[model samples]
Target: MRGLLPQLVMRVLAAGLLTVVVAAGWVLWDTARAARRDAQTTAALVSDAIAARPSFEGLAFGGVAPTPVFRDWQQFPAWSLIAPGICVELGPRDQPIQRRCGPYLAAATPPDWFVWLANRLGLVPEPVAVPVRTRYVSDAYVTAIADPGVIVTRAWARTGDLMRVAVGMAIGGAVLTGLLMIRLLAPFGLLLRGIEHLQRGDFTGRLPRLRVAEFDRLSSAVNDTAAALQEAQAARAELTRRLFSVQENERRALARELHDEFGQCLTATRAMAAAIAQSGESTAQDGARIAEISGQMMDSLRAELARLRPPDLDDLGLRPALERMVANWRARMPSVRFELGLAGPIDAVPDDLALSLYRIAQECVTNAIRHGTPTHIALHIEVGDAITLTAADDGSPRHGGTIDSGYGLLGIRERVDALGGSFVLAPVENGMRAVARLPL
Candidate 1:
């Protein structure tokens, strides 16, 4: 979501820029083409106007030169008011008379590049010759050169004006597009914030409905997922609480039975056997054997009870209990090297969390020894915003073949999940690694 806004903005800007560029190019091309056509039309009109003069008509029908009507027509000041771009020249074919209204001689003509561009686009008009008949001469004509630069320059000016308008339109369109994009993506921003909340474990947060149907549907889906996660978390927490209660009760009952019933009976039998051995001579050897057997049974029962629930975990705290557990494993498998790294305030961890972490570690070590046949094992625990436990072993990952599922891994996963944690078991360089993370 954080990245989405910038990405969308860039896309919109790119598309808008492309449209503006293409439209501007098209406008320029079309303007030049229309300006050329207008120049040609103006040139033709100027030629027609020159040919319509009465003097020119009489000359064409054989009227004599230097006549009064011809002189007046040639000297008419009204010719100066002819179409602005046309130059009227009055004279015989071989001799020049006078010229009027020419854009080339005008003071306000455009620059060379503008004229060149206009001329290239066929905007420069050509001369049109009108012939007149003289009684004494076979060939005589008046030439009108329409200086299309006047109309072409005006057309170019208009084109420039239209181009400015086009640019304005393009800028306005880009601005509007930006505003529209922001409006359309507003719902996505809301969705993004909601997703961020979910990532931070605030599953109670829900996305609001948006005006767009598609966005609304997406929001609804995200809300539904959050709701489901919230419910599932609650249910899992309850189930974990109940499971812990049941496990504690079972441990207490078993410990009580082993201590109050089995322990008392074994003690009484050992006392009787010791008395029998001390009192008699012939039965002494048999009594001694019985006493030894009963004493061994009591010691084994106590060890088993300790394994079920270590008293050190309750009285001495987690560190000692974990150290003792690891030491016992090292003693059992003297060939396997074990290393433990505990950082931060491990002793301050809650009893339940400590116990769960201990169990998970215990399972990982057991699995590594039995399946991985590891020669080296490393256990690392870090207590921070969350508890992270990592176990790595250097041994055959597959043992003799592919690893099979067992109650050990399943129990570890269930315990971690119950504590609202994640567990992963994967093959590492030499053997296997197990990692677990639990929120505080």
Candidate 2:
């Protein structure tokens, strides 16, 4: 579950630390090797200086008390150059007549482990001895010992500086690596936030541009998707409002038909029946009158039912239903020329789609006749890759063509939109045109 930023920082820290360790280790090894060589050379030089003294051999001859010839240890030329980390002594016995030591620690004091490691690795050179003899008999021995602990101490001191640098570099590298990763991955954060907005049904959210090519492309795609979704949401909201409005209108119209048409027709029929009964003889004329009244009531009922759903739409299919509607409209508006053009596979049209097309067409025709009062109304339906219905009229479109002018056209627009189609009502040169296109 580790994130990318953390992992990157760790790797960078490790790399920085490793580099420091390897470099520091090499330096330490090189220092150790040079220290060993320096110790040996110092020892040899010190011993040779001691041997070159004029009375050096005689001073330790016969192992007797100190003679007048023995000079103080500091008086000898050999005393001055007992280089650091070296020791010089006289005589072969366990106790030397004279002795001098170089610095016990020429560098910083080191830990016991450092010294042990130095000795183990042969970084501390071996002791050197030079015997000063008068003739065949040995007078004394001059010894130079590389017994001082300076090499390890010096190496350890240098290692301390390296460790500090290593620590600083590691920390700095980790911090810089983390910051860089966060900056580079900032786009991903924005993407997630955009997705959150989508989850909350807020398609309006947008993302900023990114410098990286891959991230920029991803951001662009997200922006495009969000724009599309926002548009779709707006459309859906509009469609829902239209649906409610249409439903309410249908309800009000149904109520009116029930109260004004059905109610009065029933009252008149009952009055006529009472009149016929009072006469005690239902004559042919009286029966004919009742039959006529019944026929009128039936027509009213059929009209009310058709307003909700046209019966022909289900039983006969889109083409035939539309044709019948045109015939009926022609009968109603005899003076107006009405044309219904049908093409493509109309019968195989899905029921829901057929209903939508039929309803929109019906609204267009009804609106034109009732409001526009056009002299000639042209309606066409064609189905190909998509279904298109265009209704135009030579009549005046000033009243009914404006979408905002009436609920009828609004309902038509809604139906087309619900079918994922386009609807437009605009005035052409001669008259107004309404076009609706729905995908198959």
Candidate 3:
């Protein structure tokens, strides 16, 4: 049980941790993606700002008379270099005359990411021939003047550095959250231990309040379950004691009935037979009367012996006992055809089990003969781990009813149930079926 608890806890904890990890990781990844998107958008705006400048737009090396150099420069004067590490430049491919519009020197080339962005924005034709290295570039933008000039700019570098810092914080937060979950779940182990102790018949331990409301409720439920189980055990023990007491009393009464009633009747019959034999008569009529009286006494004696302890049960076990019972029923009701199929041997059964099974069968047959008023009755018995006795017949039920709680059937049910067995009475396809299955 102790070994089992940790496995259960691990299963629960793993499920909870997986849920948290999936949710938190999704949020972190989405935030990172959104940050990268925002960085790119900012870079594009800065590049466009630098590109729309008059002097930077296809300006020749010496022809600068069309637009003033310093008048409209303030409107878009390399604001792409507004932040640290940002740079922008406009260079002509014809004469290699580069105008430094932004913060960095014109000799510097923009990062590869900026060149790719420039091509995607249609500032240059497909497949720009610039050789550039691959690296993490948060945001950069570039523009080209069809083959005459190319402008490149850096923007949102500060946003890139901020994103890196945010990623670090997100990872640290995830670790800290996982640690907190572990701490919160630690008390669950205590609750589990408390349940284990209760299962091992130790109910003294009380779990300390975890301060978590949910855990507190769980602890209360565990304590209640332990209390309920203890109460049920006590009640069951008391009921068993009462049932045993009743059984003992019944056994004592049966013993007394056999010894007092049957014993006295047999003793008187034996004495009467001896006296009649000693006082023999010579007349043939008197001899015949004496023989008849003796025969009646013997038959009565046999019936008394059978009542005290059924001789058929001892002689042929359950099968012959049921057969004799069926024969007796047939003799009593000449109109009824009683069929008996004692299917299997029942010799190995204990005394109590045999008695319970025989009583159930006798009661069911008696009920059928009394109330069913059937033309035919069938009795079937088989013994295995349990004794199954069934009495089915083509007869109508009593009380103008198809179903009722008759005394005999009720007694059979009570007896079978007392011995941890099953009793069933239902209408079969042809007639009613009475069944008692008692454990051997």
- Each candidate structure's TM-score, on Cα atoms with residue i matched to residue i, is 0.58, 0.44, 0.39
Reference-based lDDT, residue 54, model 3: 34
1-440 in candidate 2: lDDT tens per residue?
Answer: 99878888999999989988897778778876665565566556654554444444545677554333334445645335666666677667466677776654446687788777767766665666666543323566666666545666777778878888888989897998799889988888888898888886677778998999998898889889889998987889577656755775675578667767776777677577656756757474675577577767767777766666566776677887888889988888799898888888888888767777787888888877666658899999999999989999976646345455435877776666566678878777777888889999
In candidate 2, position 107 carries an lDDT of 63
Per-residue alpha-carbon lDDT of candidate 3 for residues 231-319, written as tens digits (9 for 90 to 100) = 76566545744664476456556756765776676566656655665666555455455656756766775665554456688667766
Clashing pairs in 1: 59-133
Report model 3's TM-score to 2 decimal places. Answer: 0.39
- Which residues of candidate 3, in runs, are more than 4 Å off? 1-308, 397-407
TM-score winner between candidates 2 and 3: 2
Model 3 clashing residue pairs (backbone): none
Top-TM-score candidate index: 1
Candidate 1 residues 20-60, lDDT tens each?
55764565466555444443444454434444543445556
Q: What CA root-mean-square deviation does each model show from the true structure?
A: 7.9, 16.1, 14.4
